[model samples]
Target: MEDFYPSRISEKPQIMKRRDPVIHTDRKHDHEAPLTKDQLDFYEENGFLQIENLFSDKEVAAMQKAIFELQESNSCVQSEKMIREPNSNEIRSIFAVDQDDDYFKDIAADQRLLDIVNHLLGSDVYVHQSRINYKPGFSGKEFNWHSDFETWHTEDGMPRMRALSMSIALSDNYVHNGPLMLVPGSHKYYVSCIGATPEDNYKESLKTQKVGVPDNDSLKWLVDQGGGLSVATGKAGTITIFESNTMHASTSNMTPYPRNNLFMVYNSVENKLVEPFAGAGERPEYIAVRKTTEPLGKEKILK
Candidate 1:
């Protein structure tokens, strides 16, 4: 309901989009295939990988249509997981679509996605969370520099950093449209808060709908050691996979172009969650799933 601005951005200048080598051209695949040795090595060393044109134009269109329809429907409005922009009424995010509709559920269980997750996380992975982010033109705000595991560990009670997130571009992510940026090789170090503890930070996230950001010194050190920043940008079908502990951020979309992406977090079945933080039990099923070990089926494959 309120405009949530990160403390770090108060004094900082407008976040600039970096032009690094975060987009991959050679690793593209159409069907379900395991990651190549080079892809694995890159992911291991850098903590992130980007594959271009992994999904077909037709498949992206179908998912995009579903998203638009759902956004307009009354069901999505009542779901309470549909987050709005800080100031405007435009929809910013829709969480846990798998539980609401069959289209997203099939997409969630697609073998093409599962195969890649298996390669990175080994077999027996379950969906920890799934959502579609809408970075509407001129209004989408910046996501601050933060590790997803920090929130998952502190708020959702995730035991370890055995999870990873896959972001599928439903709309083209251009440099001007707030494409995700990551500091390569930053996953090796779990940067603890210089200010708030994990629990206290989780409370802030609940109020603001944004994660706790890394301090200025920590961000500078990470950029210096991790080989600088790289932005993920590509066509609608491109997919970006990153480790849960990777330090990542995105700037505000100032251009007229809107960027939309489907984000899914997959966790190893062995590393289930515990309710450590207060009010964790009351969290919705769509935001934090309770099911475990349900590997997605091979019903929907992108051609």
Candidate 2:
């Protein structure tokens, strides 16, 4: 198999210097708080954490309304990042929502989220990407098993797996609605995939309406090392944070209920992407962000 390369493969700087981790002590925001000992321990041991009811109903509803409006609008750029569902024309994912709208931008900078991310990363964080995934009832496609860091590192020029993903369910994530499934503690094994490259995977996803998955051998090895697969199911406000290297996937939504989730990826400021893989110019600002380390202020938080 040919070695996989990110979309844009110019002879630019391909690697970045990994930054040393440092504990952030200054908590300038009211919502900012350090993670408890148990919470930290659990994340370190399992590579993920599920925090129930992290957002209030009003907050969730407001975001849902915004997403619905975006979906209803016909003007959203139909880029590869804003992918459509396999069979139907409905959008399956909306990438870089933070850059596209103010409401999502604030959510991306929420102190409640940054505090935990800051603690885990032991340094300042920047939004690498923000997206809203729409798993429409009965029509939602499957997301094949894969590790996020693999793509970020190989395609986006992210130096290491110091980033993490936070997913907030906009609708109740039930087992029947194709909730995300993760392999516990799989972050320990950074499986170098051999099959489709990131660019090919994106093309195939557009064609098949499914995420590009890992090879069968890698999948089996990850499951064996991580113990098994676990589903993430919870109320609308529940939040889940997973390490960048964790292997995760979701099944097709066969039920009539929809599962919508907001996903944000925060990368350590010190580990910014070198160059986008997509092409000559920068990848769309909404897909892979230009690195900025300025911390989010309290004023950015939504009430």
Candidate 3:
């Protein structure tokens, strides 16, 4: 239709040929096996854990290509601050889809991811929501400290609610390259200082800032109380698992490169969504999956 995303014609291929870790990595079976008793305890106690080199080089290539294609077409919206729109024009951004893609389809069948979720929430889990994020150099914004569950928590203190999250880094992320950050064990608190007022919107207020390198007192408190700004730095294709209540955020893209990643959320079958900031009662683009008949493996089914 109309040219929404400003097209940049470059001699370089649209999708980088060699699969730059700076851009994407391949999906692979990770060493971070489904949680042992120790890992489960660690997760319970710490709120988050890391899986190194979870994706292979090839998988990263395909995912990166797909994301770049999406970016070129303006299917994503990019901004420095958090402002919700039905659609956006930014190259590096997230999308709500009614259809499935190869990447997500593969993610849907990933046993290891399911196994971890099962350990935490139980086997009868469903894909509550998924987001594709591309953080481009100089333009990518910061996602401040917050919890996903608090943003859309159902009433009645539902058990096994949005239980867990799987975040895959599509590209090599370094401290300067704007990696994700988290507050260890913060999820156990079950509270999120989500900005209720316009000024309180962390994304809006801290648009032009970086995490891990705090410049103010509030930020210093956040860094100190937690791991004191633990950078989610890792090789390309790393996947991190965290409780849904985990307080996490990402640094700003200060370097001249971009950081692209995807975040997927799964809810226990019994849980439903209740949007806190419905914004004039407009429904956000979130979809639920049907309960599948496939066996979720013993590892996934919580005892």
Clashing pairs in 2: 7-277, 8-277, 8-278
Per-residue C-alpha lDDT of model 2 across residues 220-280, encoded as one tens digit per residue:
7768877888899999878999988778888889999999989999887767787543323
lDDT of all predictions: 0.71, 0.71, 0.52
Error of 3 at 191 (Å): 3.1
| Stretches of candidate 3 exceeding 4 Å from the true structure | 1-33, 73-88, 154-162, 192-227, 274-282, 287-303
After superposition, the stretches of candidate 2 with alpha carbons farther than 4 Å from their true spots are 1-33, 75-81, 195-201, 205-212, 275-283, 291-293, 298-303
* Residue 218, model 2: Cα distance from true site in angstroms: 2.7
For 10-96, candidate 3 gives per-residue lDDT tens digits of: 222121111111101112322333655565556666677778755678877877787677556554444332233213345444444
**Against the hidden reference, what TM-scores do the models get?**
0.81, 0.81, 0.67
Q: RMSD in angstroms, all models?
A: 8.2, 6.2, 13.7
**TM-score of candidate 3 to 2 decimals:** 0.67
Kindly indicate the candidate among 2 and 3 with the higher lDDT: 2
Global CA lDDT computed for model 3: 0.52
- Least accurate 10 contiguous residues by lDDT in model 1: 1-10
In order, how many clashes per candidate?
0, 3, 9
TM-score of 2: 0.81
